[model samples]
Each structure stands twice: as structure tokens, then as C-alpha cells.
Target: MLPDQSYHIYNHANGSENIFREEENYRFFLHQYEKYLSAVVDTYAFCLMPNHFHLLVGVKEEAELARTFPKFETLEKLVSKQFSNFFSSYTQSFNKVYTRKGSLFIKNFKRKPILTECQWQDTFLYIHLNPIKHGFVKDLRNWKWSSFHGYESAKNPSKLERSYYLNYFDSWQHANYLMNIKKEAIMKEEME
Candidate 1:
């Protein structure tokens, strides 16, 4: 995680245990993330599942980060530290609630750089469509946990970067159409 770079980061549980056991579990995980990384990263979209979660985020600009953390020499290390803290915060709370101990998520979150418009669009769709892909829901719009819901309900108050879609598609409605029309191919590719 470097400054001003967009990445698709995701992680699953260590075993069969779920990372989110209840609705509050999901909200708490998100709250922890916001508390730790809101200033360090620009959140684009996210999806929290039963045993894993995905996030499409971009590191804050280099100049902004440098100003924010004047004591840190390398912004990458600072960004990584924030993420570590976030994971640790969630793990501690989750462990206590479950009445069990040990790692909740697999070590070292998997991340892929979003280098092009195509990759960014793919990642955005991928993250939003995770519930459907995982069989958690048949309709993406009904999944209240995902940022995809933000697109449909303009009144949805969230920290997500909802306007990112406007950069790729003509409007929010068009963005919705693109995502829906491409659903079949996207789901097919995910299966492969």
C-alpha cells in the first residue's frame, strides 16, 4: 500500500470460522476500518461477507500524507501500519465477542493494483457483486452490506466514494446499467 495508489484488497478467515457472525459484527468491522484508515485512504467501495471482505481503496495523495504524518519518512510504512492497526482492532473485538482466541483473518491481505480504467471498473463491479458471486444474495441491490446499494438510493448515507462511477460512466443510472448488463460475463469470469 503506497500513497496515491488504488488497490483491490481482500482477505478471508483462517479456517471455517466466520469473520462476521452477526450484523453488528459487520458494522463494527467497518467502523474499525473508518476509525483507523479514513484519513489514510480514499475508500471507493467495499463488500463484507460471512468469512471474508473486499475493499477498493486508494491511498491518500503523497503530499497529503506527508503533511498528515510529518514524523514518518516513508508513506508506505505509515499506510501499512494503519491497515495493521485496523486488522488488529477488529480481531481483538471479534475474538472477545466470539469467546475464542487466535487469528480471525488469514495473514497478509491480498492486494492487486488497479492500473487502468478497465481494471478499476472490473474491480468496482467485482467488489459490489461479491454477495451474488458468493451466493449470499440473488439480487445485488438487496444486499444492504455492500456499497452497491449506495448507487440506487441517493439518500444512502455512507463513506463510500459513490461518485467514482461518474468518472467511468455517463451517469449513475448508466453505471447501474453497465454493471447489470455485464453481470453475466463478470459472474462467468469469476467462476472461471
Candidate 2:
């Protein structure tokens, strides 16, 4: 895996995509994501498709976000504590509701570092515009499942510093570079 390659993850519904078709499943996923955000992660952006989801998170180097246990004094311990607790809780809830599941996620979470400003911008665009590219909505801002509207419309409060998105270009018009990402990427298996 390259440092800046996007980390894509998925979990099947007992070897099928059927589970994702329900609104309840999406709601569960959102709840779990919020827990992760409130605890282990700083969410810059996200786009939730039907069967899978995408997130761009900045990991804190130290200081755990929440804890039901005694204090953790190391970054490694903090990371492990949050991920394990979050995943376990989600899996239990999912299995109880769905009545089947060996695992709710594929593996230990995968990560890819964003090395340059260009890659960072592209990744953000890719995540934000995903719903649009899939024909889910006519405009990126109309999609309820993504952070594009939040970053672009100021409708959602995200954990990322607003300055990072603003600093990408001289003006939002100049940074409205989202239109340039190839639609062909919609056919790519990892992201689309």
C-alpha cells in the first residue's frame, strides 16, 4: 500500500449486500461512525454509499478521546482501546439486530497517508463528490450522505479545521476543482 493511497473498507451482509439496503443499517452505520468520531478520530470528511462508506480522519498522536477504563498513558494503548471498543460495540449491535454475522468489518482498519497537498485535495474531492458521480444526486451539494455540502455549504459541523479546506485555494471558486476529477473513477472498483 502506498502512503497516500485511499483506504477502502467493506463488510458483507453474511456474504451478501442485502443488509445495506435497509435504512436501519445505514442508521446503525452512522451511529457507529459518530462514536468513532467522538472518540478515536477527527473526521475531515465522509461519504456514505449503500453497502460501504468512506471517511477521511486525522488520528491524534496522543490523548485518548473517551474511556470507560482507567487512564491509558501511551498512544499505542489509546489507539487500540478506541478501535477495539468501537468495533466491538458496533459488531454486537449489528449482530443482534440482523440476527447473523461473524464479523461486521473485514479486518483491522487499513490506513493510507496523504503525502502532498495535491493528493489531499483529490482525496477530499473524491470523497465529497462520490454520491454525485454515482448518479445518486444531480449536484454534490444535494447529497445527504457526504461532507461536500458541509465543506462547501457550511451546513454541517465537521471536526476538521475549516482553514484546511479554505487554504487549498485563493477562493472557493478557484478550489471548486471538484469538477475536474475524472468521472471514469466512478468505474474503479476501490472507490466506485
Candidate 3:
């Protein structure tokens, strides 16, 4: 069931290292991302990878969210249209730069609902760790591309819902919780 009630989405990259390699490409993607984020719903966490991105979004209304996407008037179409906007925006920029043509992403963006308290916590930790997982930095604190530092320590530098995030965990404990996520445990749990 899609947008069964509004959900948190997990969207992956096309192949690998495709989206956030160059400064210009990253900027373009971020601009569209910010635009789309502004258009609908609230985001709890987001991680932009070289090839893909992940988001933890709270849906305001499943129907309204679907309506905002021009290509989709229904929840099912929302998935394709949403990614279409992202990849199409990026590809248009990329094509002009490289004089290339064709799709940038593999296909539609992936989606999943954060249906449980454990899922909410785990998904938050997972997205925050993306930079570290990919070896972009030695610590979650080092990645400037993510919302982790914004939520945990600094001001809402990314224009995200920081006040809402602040309700999720104690300020002091936020860092500890993210740092101490056991990879094996999370993999097992999320898989199941």
C-alpha cells in the first residue's frame, strides 16, 4: 500500500556515486531537493550520497502530498513523479554540462513507511550515518551534507525542522545515540 497514510521514504541512487560528486552537481541537486522539500510535508532527516539519497519525511496528508507532485494525482504515481522531478532536474543540468542525454537515475525512487517507534529511531540513525558509512568523513560530526549536526548540536543550518527534531532526543544524548548504532544490529532489525 503506497502512501497508505503518508510515510517516510527511502530513495536510492541510480548506479553508484552518481548524484553528489562535483560541486555544481551537488548544488543543483540540493536546490531542487530544497524546493521539493519546501513544497510538501516535513522532513526529519536526509542524507545525500554520491549516487543516492535517503529521507525521513512526515507526511502532512497523503492525498495533499500526492497532489503537490504534478505528475501524480494519486499516491501510486507520487513515487515516479517525485523521482522524476529529482533526476530530471539533475539530468537537465548534467546534460547541458556534458552535452549528454538519457536518464540519470535507474528508475523510480524507493519508498518505505516508518511505521514503528524503533523504525523511526533506527531510520534516523541510519540516514545520519550515511557519510560515515561511505567513508566521506571519520565522524558524523564531520559531514556537512547531512541534518545530523543540525539536529544534534548546531543551529538549524539546513533550514530543517529543528524544533520538532529537538523533541526526539535529549541534546546530550543525540550524539551518543547516533554514534553508538550497532551496524549489525540495525541491519538485522531493518532487514526483518
Query: For each candidate, what TM-score against the reference?
Result: 0.92, 0.71, 0.74
* Tens digits of lDDT, candidate 2, 1-192: 221132332333334454455677666766776776455555666777765566766554342432433365654566556666766777788778878767766556555566677876677667776776667775676677666656676556654545555545665566565444444455454353
C-alpha RMSD values across all candidates: 2.2, 5.0, 4.9
Local distance difference test, candidate 3 = 0.65
TM-score of 2: 0.71
lDDT of each: 0.86, 0.59, 0.65
10 residues in a row with least lDDT, candidate 1: 160-169
**Candidate with better lDDT, 1 vs 3:** 1
- Residue 134, model 1, lDDT: 78
Q: Model 1: residues >4 Å from true position, as ranges?
A: 185-192
Candidate order, lDDT descending: 1, 3, 2
**Model 2 residue 139 lDDT?**
64
Give the number of the best model, judged by lDDT. 1
TM-score-better candidate, 1 vs 2: 1
**Residue 175 of candidate 3: its Cα lDDT?**
40
